[model samples]
Target chain A: MSDGYTESTIEVAGLPIQVLRGGEGPSVLVIHHETGNPGWLEFHNALSGSRDTILPTLPGWDGTERGDWMRSVRDIAAVCSLLLDELGVADVTLVGLGFGGYVAAEMATANQSRLSELVLVNAVGLQPEDGEIRDQFLEAHADYVKSCFADPANFTDLYGEEVSTEQLIAWDANREMTARTAWKPFLYSQTLPHLLRNVTVKTKVIRGTQDTVVPAAVAHQYVSLLGDAQLIELVGGHNLESDAPEALAEAIVA
Target chain B: MHLMYFTEQPMSAYDEHAAEEGVTALLFSNSNFDPVAGSQLYNDRLTEYKLAEEVGVDGIMLNEHHNAPFCMQAKCNIWASVLAGATERVKIVLLGNPLPLADNPIRLAEELAMIDMISGGRLVSGFVRGGGTEQLATGVNPAYNRERFEEAHDLIVEAWTRPGPFRWEGRHYQHRVVNPWALPMQQPHPRIWIPGVLSRETVIWAAKHRYPYIALNTTIEATKRIWQTYDDAANEVGYDPGPENRGYLLRVHVADTTEKAMQNASQFMWMQGEFTGLAHPVWSNPAGYASPRNREALVEVMNGRRPPPRAQSFDNQIENMQIIAGTPDECIRKLRTILEETRPGILALWGNDGRVTHEDSMRCIELLGTEVMPALRDIGAELDLDGPFDSEPPVSISYDEAAKARVASAAAASGD
Candidate 1:
């Protein structure tokens, strides 16, 4: 409709953050992934009809500014809580990516009364005793995240040139920022799973079966740890929200 | 079809800043650039080339490549045709078409002549002996590379110049007639540019023919050796390898000041590093061009012996690559120095380098058009550029029209 979305910059706890708001109806605080832009509002407009969604550009992602003291996961969660307060948005259905999932976990633990529902799409907020978070897809098959849906030609048409070194470095920095705020002993357990008992919100964990970054087995463990959380295995990988937005749309609406 | 598209993403503000000093903008392509979301990189380059006319560039240059990311196009003719269709007021340059590797030189000749006629004669036909991995994939014999290239060159020239139906059978080529109906639009032929990497045969040949010789980007020392050979050959032929006859493509950028230029140029430097420092060997011995001299040189150039100067960024990489990447004042001084050192009639500036933004490139067009070009006018006239090709009328309609016309059954089966 009006394109995916666009955000106006707002200061929360003295930090300048780009807050993406789109769709209509009940507010869903949607935190986008790294490499994701506000252009996603076009997709949201297509799905929600009149449902309103909110996306916050996390600090140091793209060009958004982060506070010097915003260090750990708990710190980011507190900042987001303050951000919601400034926006007068209470009890949001927290949506997140890898680092955003970790922030969502921390927010669910600290502000239990604020979240109505949670959607973690190919999220990475869990730990596994088996292998490390398999980021194999990043280095190996970085070509196609939607090979099943279309063709390599379509992906190139959309993605253009392979991401350059500078862009990659910027991406790496964003991930490190996520790690700084969320990673700790045993990964997602720092707040999630243990905090799962208190998370009364309608939570759904949607993952791509072929996601190399967060293995499907690890996602299964994530669902097992949560109480009454719905789990969905779809087509696509880590960036499945964008890659297979239709499948994700079906998962979210269903 | 091997397609070679030159990604000449220009840096505008920097170019403007450089232009103030009466210097041309430098261009280059980024090797390691891919966006997670949006258009493909080479397509972006095509779009830039298409706009080269409005951008006021002297020539839209392209080169050859295989696996390395520096150049995406293996065959430059495809992009040349695309450019032929897209821009009207800029010279179309296939900075080189490697002659030695082609199994059919006639096809190459036919295509280039078609482009020359198509562009209404504003084509700069560049011939070269392809370097690096191309030699390997094409199965050319290295030892006989020069001979094959020269022979092929002669055959093609004969085809272009010869007026009619004459039989030609040579060591590597045979044609029933020297000339076909698809003659070039130009009275004689489009100007030819010879891009020499390290080939002495290329130098001697260009000098003998008085064709413009452009040295591919290399060390000053290496370039000096090439110039020496070219000059000596010209002397032997009683011709002057003067300013109009020699040129080089340097990676350059410009900005308001030296510091600003350096800061803005980091991406370009990084791109150069990626292009020149590919893990794959840049030069290799392939089957068709089996020349002993070529094979040895290929190994050396591909083995990473070439020392590329470092700049802070791509913007500065333009400067360090012997392009003028400074304020107008500084750029003018640098241009003067390079001109004095090389004494070439043409200064082919490159504004596109790795990771250069479209906005910057557009600015370069403005800067060069309004500033630098005016400065160089004293030395040379505005380049002889023509308008883009006219679209062919619909063949379907014409064919239907012809079909509708009755010919009285060919006058009772009598052939007319």
Candidate 2:
């Protein structure tokens, strides 16, 4: 709560989007995961120390109205690009956590003129060569949340001992939006790997060593596909932003 | 009243323990499915339907589910088509085709029309949004489920009623050549019956369209509330709804004696966690599949604040009259209470499911068709209940008219 970030609603493409801005320097736009934006987190606080952290709640998340017109992840990507244009932020470092990473990669592929660097943390968007991207929809919400963290204790710490009805509803809304974009082809794009060939921006593909959601092969594939990308394995779970915030922040700022 | 026979046609030959170990229905691996057992079960179900027709039930109801061991009918229309050819006198009521799953509604319209023609216009076409898990299995987005369902329903209705060569364009579905050569034999298309458990939106939708809303084994209290909602919606659209606009599906198994009937009725609980718990919670109530209000109610169920209808103990269900199993006379007496309270013009008797043997099912169907159905008809006549066949349902209003009526009603309620 003491992240020094100010939250406001910004109009982009005629849709009201919730944006949280803090710190003072080159801008770093943080796209949230499928769980929606978990408010301004520890990583945002740490990143705000050096970079101007700009976190916008994706459409259909807790803070923003659902954009029924946005049918696919590409549509979301295009919107984020438009957001950057509206913000008029130059040399933006886009940090995407989990599903947000997929959006970041998509944004880069579409237009990278505004983006200086791209960081994808346990992001799911590519078909794995082996194993599979764990289906969050198939499992219980609590079980899926537990699996997202290395130690279930972190989920307890972040979400308290019991998840509130409001939090559950928000998560359901976020999952609905995720299902809208990522239901078919199942959180991965067949042509994304090929599309990454055109993403020439400097990219860091980070994965938690203990992530059970997105397979390790998928993270490696992201690194392999991106022209100027390197893989960074962190000691955490799928939600590195929450599990190892300081480390994830350092990896992005490195 | 129109009496119809129904069953989930459960394939109960699989290892029950394995099903319990995994998710029971959806996502329950098909590796446990034995084709030989499935083949026999399918034929047995067909045989039961034929017997149901022979025994004198007015109609035979069929439904389908995907990737579910609980139901073997992957496509109910296939069975509807088969029955259209095989049966002579029964209305092949589909409770119904999962409209949202069909990428091609025109093709579906053609199939339904063909079945209607083959059956001498005995097809009572119905539509459903399908279960949330079905959306996952079919790779359909649950967010677009309602949209797809409405669009598909409109397209199919248009295909049946309108002349071909019409250009169709909608949000979720589109066709340049909106023409199906095979139109329904029934004038203005076959009667549409909407079946659901507890979705208020579906009830309202059915009411707005003047389709009979069939409550699928809901509690008596819930069914009353459903009728109230339907009646209120009907009033908004400037029509007085009746029993003809309402139907109720109840799990009623009848036999010569109470003991055998009770034992056979218990088979409805043969599936692990019963019918309600057959699906994994997440799969069953996927995000966006339910409205926000309904989703909150489901959360209450998950939190154990409210028990799901099927989660009640078998005896409790019987006590509640949600399930009725007894001798012919006993069933008729109990059903009279249900009929008196719910007052559905169309009654679907869910005869058998789970491990209830085919022989017992046949006998159950026979008992229902003979003693129970005759008594029910008498009771229905005494109660002045008439099905769509007897009395015409109120005409459906256009969406725009319904919307305007809703606003007017809201304003009137607010004393505007």
Candidate 3:
């Protein structure tokens, strides 16, 4: 159990999923972005001190087989529902980043009973009136990776050694999963605004100032939908948890 | 071998400089399209197909692409219908209609059935999953591309064959009353073809059903591998597919002078690369579009590994058979080598790409008609290459026998 966590393989929706769990307080579910594994990050543990943080490496990640049943973001949200059922967690505060944020928003539309407080960090699922979401998959993998960091040089600091094959494979898998669920709408759900009206849970929208992948206006658009929600602009860019883990963690619990 | 003339009908009236902005899914602004030039191109290209029929090619192949200057013909079946009414004694091979993008496969089935009847069983129906940008443009999920493709194919085939008022409930599609009064003139249906590069699943699927698989502008080694994949898959299903089940589509421009043909070949490359530009990696490969199992091989097929030096260069394209450019005799010699190796019965000639002038294309086609045709035909005969015309396709509409059986059963029931 490294960094106050225990890892196990759990069956969710008929697929074996690798899940990471930690913390002693209320349960929290965190859905990660297209790339980067929550288990491999130090900031992921910050929440563990005060809450039970559940992180499951989504399907088509790290050689995980994608269920044919999983064809849309709503489908992935369904898996999250099944995952929560399997975990037997209730009144969960869900935290999501990037693509996961899209899934969380989708989950809120249907599974409002299970979720309480929702934290969306650099969430994608809305199209702003202006500006646009850059296609990260179009950029070079290295360039995309650098964009994920507040300082590009932190790439070397994050992994001092040359990037391993397993890392590359994991990144590819995450990208593939993202495409499966997000490609059609190109990451925005048209009905989400109407659906957001149905979700009564408290919500917080997190953003990094320098993050241009998903522009700040999109975050604002997401905030404008929820009944009880506030937009919190942070100093760091999209990689909020990585660049400002301590502050981001405090803000989530606040 | 049945020779077919094919073109993407690229609209080259656009400014080449605008391409620098970006080509996501090869998506670009339509500001460059001149209605006058585009209208002329449509007429001229159709005229070229007529000339192909006049020159007496066995078939004419057509296809559709969305949101790109690569192919102006986004509705291949419409083009097929036009060709059916406009031409005679030539197979209209629609290589084909992209299935997954269609919201209503029944309508497509009806339209195709009408086209086949109009053409008097001259239609060769082809289905494609479509290009990556297609998903982006149509908002069809790319992850469901293959599944939608398979389900749509099944639904269309069922719509054609099964006595209707039937129901189809699929993951991507649902239909209540799938009955179309319009049916093909062909006994069961017109021939079906699938064009692919290196997707193993596609190869196996085509071979398993014995649908003729056409290899697009791919490398020689890659073509062999894709064909071999098809052959091996066919063998597993207890059938040794003949040349009739395989086809090769290549860019072949033959003029009086080799210099003219080579210069025209540049136009082809310009269309492939510099024009709309390569589809962004994300759009091309949306998440569930491919699995880890076949993704690597598929990418390699798109960008050939172990390609000969200057593989992307124009000269290498000619040497590699990706582009066949030369005098008639030269084209014949090179084409013969390919025929010997691949043994494809359906040879598709892409006579024009990009901005090759209509005059140059006409001259090239005339030369192909006069000089290249006879020699290639002799070689095809020598090699014993037989197309779908010579042998019954591995899979075709079996409506004739079914109709006869229905009549016989009714007569028996009536004691007539």
What do the candidate models score in CA lDDT, each in turn?
A: 0.58, 0.86, 0.78
**Top TM-score prediction, candidate number:** 2
Minimum summed lDDT over a 10-residue window in model 3 chain B is located at B302-311
Best by lDDT: 2
Estimate candidate 1's RMSD in Å.
24.9
Candidate 3 TM-score, true structure as reference: 0.88
TM-score, each model?
0.48, 0.94, 0.88
* Per-chain TM-score (chain B), model 2: 0.93
The DockQ-based order of candidates, best leading, equals 2, 3, 1
* lDDT per residue as tens, model 2, B281-320: 6677788898977766666554444565455788998899
Query: What is every candidate's C-alpha DockQ against the true complex, given to 2 decimals?
Result: 0.01, 0.61, 0.38
Stretches of candidate 3 exceeding 4 Å from the true structure: A106-116, A126-131, A154-156, A159-165, A198-202, A218-225, B21-25, B273-282, B294-311, B393-416
lDDT by residue for model 1 (B35-144), tens: 33124555666666655566456677777654334455668888778777777867777777888788888788889888887787767788887763454445454434
Q: Write the per-residue lDDT of candidate 2 for residues A92-148, one digit (tens) a residue.
A: 999898889989999998888888999999999888898898987776566677789
TM-score values for chain B across all models: 0.72, 0.93, 0.89
Question: Residue by residue across A1-254, what tens digits does model 1's lDDT show?
Answer: 24555658778888887876777777777766544343453345545654577777776665467565665667777888888888887767777765567677677778768777787776666676466764311221222233322334434544555533333334334543543444334235544667767666778888777565665666676677666588877777566655676666666656
Q: Point out where model 1 deviates above 4 Å.
A: A1-254, B1-39, B219-221, B256-260, B272-323, B379-416
- lDDT agreement of model 3 with the native: 0.78
